[model samples]
Target: MRRRLAALLCCLLCLTGCATLAPPYETPAPASSSHWPAGAAYPTLADNAGPLAMHLPLGQVFPDQRLQQLLSLAIANNRDLRQAVIAIEQSRAQFQIEGAALLPQVDAEAQGYRERRPADLSGTGQSRITSEYRAGLGVSAYELDLFGRIRSLRDQALQTYLATEEARRAVHIGLVAEVASAWLTLAADQEHLRLARETLTSQEASYRLIQSRYDAGISSALDLHQAQTSVDNARIDIARYSRLVAQDQNALTLLVGSAIPANLLPEGLQDIRIAISEPAIGLPSQVLLQRPDILQAEHQLRAAYANIGAARAAFFPSIHLLGSFGSASAELTDLFQAGSLAWSFTPQISVPIFDAQRNRLRLRVAETERDLLLARYDKAIQTAFREVADALAAFGTLDTQLQAQRSLVDATANSYNLSQARYQQGIDSYLNVLDSQRALYRAQQELISTELGRQLNRTSLYRALGGGWYTSEPS
Candidate 1:
């Protein structure tokens, strides 16, 4: 008994001694900031003139509660996001399962049998063998993680789970941006439709007036024809805007995961308000941490770090402990007898004696993979910064454009009014009036389009800033 005890102790010490020699795990150096790609010459986010603080409730008033509700529903029920949620759950379960490997497992076994013995069976007598049920708890092949292999694997699984969560967040950020962009388009299209309707109304009135003047021989046929053409063109625009609205509606329906009722559309342009309030763009360095894609990339890099450690460990010897305990007996009643006890333990060590350089190749591969992930992470950060800069630059330039456009529209409208008055008094030819009106209409449309673009760009900036989406999902 002492000898057996001494043997078991020696086996344990052998494994423990090997455990002391575990390969040193070193985390790869973080991606260098110098490696981050250089973006364009756009102004730094800190120097940008947008709002310096990220405020909730952007204060761009959309009077349409229905649009807000639709946005909420889409966030909740969107198919892509739902699928992402399922993926997170799956990853969570997998991590948990892999983690369970670090702990021992216990189980119970039971058996009952009845057999008729034939002559010469069991050394001879013809007898009936019956066995009552017996049950006992057993442990089989429980491997002790003496070298932290299972722990490292569990850590890898954990990092993967976190990466999946970030992936889901990234999806959410994308989905919200999509919804906001679609909503902005819908709003702008509605505005365009409104302008088209107004223009059509004015053109129809002008056409009627010109037709009366022509019949009364007060104006030339050319004037009548020009007025009719304006009306026809206005009608064409109305149809085009109508089609655009329909398309936007379809897109919103798909985004929201359900059809939007007709009554749900905003009644007028005033009812559709875009939040023009700018959020604060923090320092460029902070922006790197804010972007979900960057965060996801970082998590991937971390997982790769853990993988390198695991691979390096493989270069050292591996120890496995395999053992099982059970009870058996030739006779039914003797199944639980002391003599029935059986157990075996095997302590194994497999050193890399020869593998034709396969182990070295694997280690090299792991190291290379780590480097690739590091590069990718660095690139992601740089890209994220560039997007923020781009969005901010567009926002700045578009703001100036929209302001200038509004001024031009005002000037054109005034000029058109003066020309129309002068022509009615016979001080200017009808051609001058037509020219003024056309310019005014074009300017008006352009201004509206530009304003809409400004809002859209603002939305893009918010997305690039990572907005409030980082905490959108629970940890």
Candidate 2:
């Protein structure tokens, strides 16, 4: 038995021959960028010791617990995230199947059959009945991964699984950002509505005062007409903002996968505040490694690398060990008897002697694909870094712009109030009062929009930095 084993090993070794495979992988370096956008030009906050692009610590960035709960629900119930999870499970199953290729497979087999044969040309006196029965334990086809084909495939599967995991994380981040953005829009719209109502109330009061003066034979008909026009215009905006707020609320509900509880939406815009600590992006390349998209891209590159290794390994021969042990007999009662026992062992080798260069072409194709993935990875990193910087700069500059807009709104409001009083007292013309009210209304609307813009920029920065969504903080 030892000699036979030794001979079988020799035959296996002879069939495999020798082949060289690629070495282990090393993470490629991230590319660098030089210039970034300016916050002064854009509506962004100044760095103020923080970088234009900052990596926020991941531990619970969402300040509000209610919003966090909504995000959690979205992660669990969102349709897109569920699909990504299913994809991960499929990759895991494929990994398991590929992993099993490196090990031998054993199975037990049992069968029984009956057949009748005619006595052709009187070779037998009469028709004969035959019965066959067999039972055995057998080793089925299994590949010996000498050149690491199966191992490479398993590794590829692992990378694919990781990629899917990152995809889910990315989706999670997106959902959180979307929910936050929608909430901000709702808040902004509500604030705009409030401002519109206030403006309308003030205009209505002015219209009544102007009509009283006109009835008292003090003010002109044009003054009452202008006052009525201002009130009507303000009323229109109130309706618009009210509609926008409701639309935004319904959209937020859809994103959250259920009706937004009364407690979920903040009472008013002032009650809803976005807490963003400005981040300083160290270097462009670092941003790529931190961004989930770039990480996913890197994983794809690794999967492609593993595929190339697998294709290269296909150039070599494959070895399989086969074994069978069974008992068989014409009589069913003796099918398992010692005298009916049989056993056989075979080691097979398959080499790609001639296949019209198919294997070589596959290797070539894999190489090209790996190269494509590498380039894509590099480009993705660059893009992520750019986006982070852009978002940071925008948020910083917008902070300053928001301040200016607030000041404008305040100054215009006071000016409008003084003008209305003067015009009622016959100290100024009605046209002057109309102009002031127009300016005040425009400023109020601009302030609301700028505030919303700032909040949106904050959300963009968080998404760009790949912040939040994960349970643990960023390393």
Candidate 3:
């Protein structure tokens, strides 16, 4: 009997290794074109021409030592990113819990019990007391996965965990890009403030000269008023830029999650040049697959597929084993004696016959979820393609815009100087001088703004190409 029982257990173990019912997984092709848009602006290289573009480390991406230091602090202390890391850990634990269910769970237990029986029920004239002691190692309701249900559930959990990991990577990339942009913005605002202050000083000097000429009866009241107006405008700009600089600092502080060091903060655009080299953009098909968000979406789709497998398996019979090997006796001291040795094996089989169509509904739900994830996966790819295209378009043109803006600044400066000289010699009206001054001021401001935009475009392109995270150092 013992040998037969052992053989039966072995057979059951062999039978428990069932084939998965999950549909074969195939990555759906994106509906968009295989290559990036073609144009002189949209450059492409042969797929095998060289290695795909590599992501630059944060240190290399932000060559400014101060920006690099701030990025490090943000990555370590940012609350949102810290929470994302914790979420990954939680998902990993949950996956392990689900995976453990695929195998038997053995537990050691000890117990003591006492019971009393009424005389009438005992068939004796008096009440009777009974005492029992038990100690054992047991398997309680361990499901033998003959239909792959447990296996499928485990796979689903694993994929979900992997998706969460990808999400964390996405967060890391976003944080790095945001910090770089914020630092650059603060620097630009500081430069704007400095320019306003200098312009105000120059305007005040001109106002003083025109006021003296008016007092000497050599200049009209209109000349004095116009010069004063220029001074006033410059003063107003000073105040506005001061406020903006403060606000930019506050924004950077918030992103860093702590007070930034004064030395680490940007003083001007020139001081914090975003001089990172542009990364090579590879073929769209090759690059899009590596985007963290797209990978996360694909993992979710795989998880949904696994859920469908589990649902399909639910339609078949399930077998569970509940058994215990132990000793039981009225006296605790004799619990392990020869006669006290005892064992029990209970195998339960459950066949689905009628459950109000619950199994069918579950299968339908899984299928619907899979379809939803499939749509989301495709959307992720499409969105990435659009972002890359837009960034590339901006990058191809911003340098030209910057170049034109610098020329405009130079031309306006020359016009201002010539107009001032003509006004002093009584060859032109003060209005022309004022007009020239205004034009020069506007052109200078635009040049600063354009320079900042050019730098920011590089950052955006790096992020759009998914080059900021997962390749090296954290930030």
Candidate 4:
């Protein structure tokens, strides 16, 4: 009889987790075009058509030694990224915790007891004493996943863990982009500061020339004051750009999570202008799927599906088994001796006969959550499409704009020189020189801005295409 019962238990164990009621999951179709949008906004690229960002790591993207070193520091020290990594570990442990539920939980225990009773309370009508001791090995209430409830839970945890890992990758990509962006901004601002100081020095010299002319009656008070005003304006700008450069440095330091070395600070944006090269963008919308944010969304949707399976199993009966084997004796010395063997086996089946529709509601909640995640997954893809398109639009026209701006600076510089020579030859008023100088300075500033814009847009395109995503997953 015992052998037959043991065989029956073995068959039950084999039959456990044989079924799942969860609906099959299907990846949602993206509501976007197969190819990049084409128009004046999305111009053709002369770049050699090749791979996307998967082959473009950070080392290739920035190429600047100082920027590369800064990126390394940020990756090693950024608190936000550290937290994301810690969250991946947390999720991994949670997955393992849930997985352990699929097996029996064995426990070992030991106990001792002593008691004395008065004669009035004793059935023997005399004072009595008793001593008892017990020791055992047991399987706690281990749920048999006949309907895949435990398996579904484990699946849900695994997917969630994977999603967390993807989230960490997303953080990493964003951090690299942010550090590079900040560094570029600092370089641009520093260039602006240097230009302002140079302008101040030139204007100071011009002021002295105008003062000497006024003393000799060769210039009017109006001319003298105007020259002084130009000098003051340069001074104001120098101060303003100085403040901006300092602020940019502070922001970059914050992103790096440590003080940046003096040598690593960018001297000018020119050095980094060609550092970030745009890829050929030869791939299709499928490339967007590789983005960490989108992958994280897909994993979360999968976890929601697993949750639905677990909820569905809640409507069926669940079986829990508790068993133990041990030896107990009244004497401590004989606790583990023969003839003192103790054992027990309990099989519990909890049928969900009725619970005021609790199980139905739980299943509904799980299904609704799945629907929510599916919608999110679809939105993530659409958002990615828009970001890439916007970056492309800016990238398409930025080079033309930069060339036009450089031409403008050259034209203004020629005009400024001619105006200054005419004023010295007494053929034109000082106003013309002042106006030309102002125009030339503004044009130069615009050229710097345009160059900076081109570089930043290149970085944006790289990020939108999910650069810096390749990394080691948790082992």
lDDT of 2 at 10: 70
Q: What lDDT tens digits, residue by residue, belong to model 2 across residues 118-218?
A: 87744687888889888898888766677878778888888888888888778878887898888888878888888889989988988888898999989
lDDT (CA) per prediction = 0.70, 0.76, 0.85, 0.85
lDDT of 1 at 305: 67
Q: Write the per-residue lDDT of candidate 4 for residues 1-475, one digit (tens) a residue.
A: 7799799789888877586677798888776666777799776743322444344556776888888899999999999999999999999999999999989998998899989999999899999988899898889999988889988999999999999999998898889888888888889888889899999999999999999999999999999999998999999998999999999999988889998999999999776754544445644454688888999999999999999999999988988999888988899999978899988889999998879999899999999999899889988888998988898899888988988998899999999999999999999999999999999999999888888888888777777877742222222
Off by over 4 Å in 1: 1-64, 111-135, 261-264, 268-279, 337-340, 469-475
For candidate 2, the per-residue lDDT at 136 reads 92
Weakest 10 consecutive residues, lDDT, candidate 1?
466-475
- Report the Cα lDDT for candidate 2: 0.76
Error of 3 at 112 (Å): 1.5
lDDT of 3 by residue, 1-475 (tens): 9899989888887776777788889999985678767666653433432444566666766789888889899999998899999999999998999889977999998899998999987778789998999999999999888778888898999999999999998988888888889899888888888999999999999989988999999999999999989999988998999999889889888888998989898787875655554335556776888888988999999999999989999999988999998999998899998999878899999999999999999999999999999999988999999998887777777777889999999999999999999999999999999999999999989988998997888788778777652222211
RMSD to truth, every model: 5.4, 4.2, 2.9, 3.4
Question: Quick one: best TM-score, which candidate?
Answer: 3
The candidate with the higher lDDT, 2 or 3, is 3
